[model samples]
Target chain A: MSLETGTGAASDPAAAPEEAAEADSLGDLSEFDVSSLAYGAVGTTVFLALWQAAALAVGRTYLLPSPIEVATAFVVELTAPTTFTVPFVGASLPATRLTANLLQSLLHYLPGLVVGSVLGIALGVGMGWSGRLDDALTPVTRFLRPIPPLAWIVFAIVWIGIGHGGAAFIVGIGAFWINFYNAYAGVEGVSTHLREVAASLGVDDDLTMIRKVVLPAATPSIATGIRTSIGQCWMIVVAAELFGAPGVGFQIINAAQNLATDVSVAYMAVISLVFLVSDGAFRRVERRVLAWRD
Target chain B: MAGLSEPSASEPRSDDAKVVVDGVGKVYESERQRVRALSGVDFTVDDGEFVCLVGPSGCGKTTLFRTIAGLEAATDGEIRLDGDPVTGPGTDRGMVFQEYGLFPWRTVRENVAFGLEEQGVPEPERSSRVGEMLGLVGLAEFADAYPKELSGGMKQRVGIARALAVDPEILLADEPFGSVDAQTRDMLHEELLRIWSETEKTVLFVTHDVEEAVKLSDRVVVMAADPGRVSEIVDVDLDRPRERTEPAFADYVDRIRTLIGE
Candidate 1:
């Protein structure tokens, strides 16, 4: 009783070594888990080793490029300038590196992602809430869902010409289906009790009930749909550009046509890098919007 | 139960009652089977009276309560409130659910202000009412907290605050204390009684607990399970601040249990 642990008292000596040991165990990679980072590094090292072994055995860059050759080609693509066509404006513009390529690809990707997502969610909510709309749209959706997004390439080229509009149309179709099912399931999954609660609280009207109760309750699902489409659109964008558009995918095809596999692989890696950065940015935004889920 | 003097005066007269549930019945029929939730269930609550509809799980007390709340339509008879037939959910009736139906996405203050917003009350008055209701439920300090951040008892308190925020003529609470622990249930019972006496709004509380019924109700209407009929109505004439440990309190609980054939 004589000794007291007063406010802002001196720290315990026994805990100092424990804290020091903890700090020593976790020196760097503080932002991420150290063991998981180690495992990822190990995985990449193993993959590169296997790839190098195969390349050395073949002893040919044209057929199978080494990791070093591909890395050097990647740096060249990052810095080199090239000639390209501006899709809608019909102007041939000189641009440097992957920057212009990514920007042009985004010009198509952004519009397609937005338009497809908006239309899909709107239609999905309508189908879920009203039986008549569901019956009318269900048959058409089932027929369209079977056709691959790539099949739209011929129609896209025919309708909008082989340009950014054509590529964007293909990306839009891919994004449409991803968001459609999610938004439909989201609205349908709204709990009956929640609707009853809304009714008892003076929100008996159909419009207010959907807006205040159904939408907020289904937001987690809707947000997930948007996130999934963000990545799916990226996949469609590269393929859409591969057919006949000016972007990283076109760069890959042009290099491969000249039997330069290293350059093709370099551009493929660039697309992956872009996807990683964009997906990471999206995750941060999604977390903030869906904070209620926590 | 111990007989009290002049129980008839406390009985709800059709002309003077706040809620008159006359021969109300609810039947749910599907292709597979026909289920009757309530049959010939009749009751009335006088103006400002605190009544509890006590029954077992399948007794259809909830169906009857929902009918009065205007969430469900009765297949037979009508529920008249203030001489008007209950058509649908309106501003005149506020309901508290067992699961504390406060929207998880909304803050405590916003949840309480939901009905007010629906009624189109202006910002100044709405804020004042929300502040008052939160204070009444002792949740003024936690006004900005979400429902997920609260305990079971506090969530129900938010539900009560939200229901009373609109100042309805009748408060319908369907097992408001059902999710809370026993200790918190006792505390909520006291809080509900205080709020009821202060607001003077007629309350139709539904619960399966016999002790809760005897403690809170001016009258407890025991319901039967099969066919969901009204078995017997027990007149609880206990004085204010009735103690659960008292012999008379035990007698009232036992009388209701026997009436329901428990």
Candidate 2:
């Protein structure tokens, strides 16, 4: 198992000598061998230094803001209050700019991700497991799948109006296709041998066999789809907000338009930070769910 | 080596026969071709008897096994279990696979309890039976471990335990020890013999290995390829804990090897 190999590599006495030899050969690089965390710190420092040098060369804050300028703008966005009007109730609430934008983004993102994933997985499994359903849906899905989620922006605006609902519709469309294909492929690719085994074991009906055998076998693949959608829906979140929705994407576009480029960069960093945190959280859950794999 | 014995003649159905495979044949047909996998295959596995179907690749041993298990339909003839025709897979027959087909997601204990759960055996009985099966296979310690955590031998033991947990009349093992190492295979052979004696369940084991069939089976049904059919039925007239080094054991192996033209 990976646990054994992982621990073996970490504790191997032979590895230490080779690592020491490599460190000695590198001179100044030996100091960086403290840990992966130290290496990450060093890498970030080098990246910031390069960015600072490039920003100095450009000498235009509007064109390319220095890391310090973006940091200042990030602090300002975090500390400053923005008025958020509670929809359907005219009460106004004060939240930091970062918090307000994040909440606004989540207003569409969470619902879109949940609703789209549920429907997509249900339909995908249905189509995959039933030959009749597959035959019926294949042509329609083939036609619809080629059209991009962004292409539906016109419909979203016309039908749902320019708000959270429209943004959610777009994000939902993106999530739907990713999950659909994955669930479909997962169910389709379930081992015939396993089905036969289930049959011999007195799991007579398809539904019982699917619940006991097919679903568990296909879980790894389905999990892959869900994990992919978690990160992918974030991209969709930004794109959905770009068209007159009040979120981090809107802030980025608005700041860029006003030539407050440092504010735009800060908002972009917020999106990255949010995505990293969300992805990491989902990964932990996925690991626990799929612990059997290891 | 002992002289070749007379092939057993096809007799009328006896009351002792637990499984009756009468002229069972399977044909795989498509637009391009129709392949006769098994033709006029006949055999009888008596109650509490250990029978091994031995053949090479394309010999249709597995096809016959599947047809008997009711996992696949026979194009011709019928397989009767306790005088009833097998229309589909039922709880009466428990099958173990060469691949050690334990669900990876389930613990070893859970895998053994699957058939019992399907049979709707309640909580106390299911848990006890699962524990009993695990103990039978000497896997009591690894009960909570997943299939992936075990070796090939251990996995097949779990498969065997799982198959036996339901307390089926017959255990259908499809080359279960075929993938394990030789040393482990020997140990498993002894374990299987002990389990067979303890449970008194009729066994229909399939294997390509002539020695494995000779080692485990009370009767080895030799099969031939190019439209597979039973070539001979060799009764292993030997004592329990039969030694591989024995001349009679080697003779049985050699005779069966010759019958399969291998």
Candidate 3:
């Protein structure tokens, strides 16, 4: 297995140009062996065409706005400015609707994601490593895991009020459970053979064994959990903002209420674009850190 | 069984013996069933002696090896090293596994340096010792390479280097060459013999292959299944680099094979 991966890694540089040449061959449109990017492009074009035809058939922009109308709304949202006041200093500033909304959403997302992920990983690794802790907490976690993040909105509203803090609490709940389960499973799946090897190598105590052997062994699994949460928290972000949080999700709901369906679609696309950027960045970091796996 | 030597279970421990397995036994008990894997297994490995435990699949040779290594506890008796009881695993006995248990995330140098690092051997000394071990294993050129970039033979070489890095008194190898091909296995046998002679460390090797047992050890401890026990211990009085094609070598292999009912 190691030899096979070594040869594959060695040949990757030579394989890249051939794959690029295959992808660049636009003349063979009927061929089924194009690159995945080309296939994605073809699929997206077909989807847009189908969507345009459906919009024309409906003949109602208020219900299902056409792609062109949504594009126009996206441009307007990107360019139009809204007044924003800086807290404590009481300075008013003008910022674009897209920029202000994105900033507001990030204010709720970043802190919640960071704090929740840390706490989740700590508790997960603790429970997974110690059988006593796992036995003590398993029943409570099993009961709480089934409840949705949105169900905690009532507590969020009562405790933190209807703002970024409240929205962040909901997003944090989602992030916590996703990361908690992944880290727990990852640690549990660590190989017994590796632990024995560590033991024979002079690692006598549980703490030293866990620090040197278990953590590195379980890193790939923990990384997968974090990556999943990176995208999953975005979903929670939109659901979190549905009440009264001043973010892109809030704009989506507010525009839909005013019969501006195109604006709602525009905000939805913004969420997707942010998710794609964050997910892609995280994947690059994952690949670099887990380069040994290949 | 006719040509085989007497069972060494009755032999008392000598003063020069580095490891003594005194009536050691292991039983695995669960809710469903209780399995006696080893029963009153006894052996002694002298200082700097190379010994091999060979048996059938269910003979508990591995269980015995792991018990001696202190990775598992004996059910009835105890294992002593240098006149001291082995309560658990320690740096004094380094282990080489069949699966080449090198840390996949670490480079060859890091893997070799692991034991020394745990021993708190500081920087320059640790680096130099790791370099020496890698050179001894003929893997100095691949020191910076990860385990995934190496072949099976090379990985096992790293495993050996890692085991030897801590300067352990005993080297416990559990089928270290079992995963490699025949040619690689032969080469590793020569390498292991050279290392044993150079380091003067007592080696307790376990394998199911009769030929491997004959080729590597100063004595072969033949084991039987159905509650594993020592069938016989055969002393090989051959010289260094013994010829496998010789009649005496084949005689020992055949005698051990028959003793195991193969």
Scored by TM-score, the top model is 2
Model 1, residue A85: C-alpha shift (Å): 7.0
Per-residue lDDT over B141-235 for candidate 1, one digit per residue giving the tens place of the 0 to 100 score = 99988888999999999999998998999899999899889999999989988898788888889999999999998888889987898888787
lDDT of 3: 0.88
**Candidate 3: misplaced stretches above 4 Å?**
A1-34, A83-94, B1-13
The C-alpha stretches of model 2 lying farther than 4 A from their native spots are A1-34, A86-93, B1-16
- Which order, best to worst by lDDT? 3, 2, 1
lDDT tens digits, residue span A23-59, model 1: 5445433535656878999999999999999999999
TM-score, first chain, each model? 0.85, 0.86, 0.86
The CAPRI classification for model 1 reads as medium
Tell me the lDDT of candidate 1: 0.84
Model 2 C-alpha lDDT per residue in residues B144-243, reported as the tens digit of each score: 9988899999999999998888888899989999899999999999999988878878889999998888888878899999999998888887777789
Alpha carbon lDDT of residue B2, candidate 1?
Answer: 17
| Higher-lDDT candidate of 1 and 3 | 3
Docking level of model 3: medium
The model with the greater DockQ, 1 or 3, is 3
**Each prediction's fraction of true contacts recovered:** 0.59, 0.83, 0.83
- Reference-based lDDT, residue B249, model 1: 97
Interface RMSD for each predicted structure: 1.4, 1.2, 0.9
What DockQ values do the models have? 0.65, 0.73, 0.79
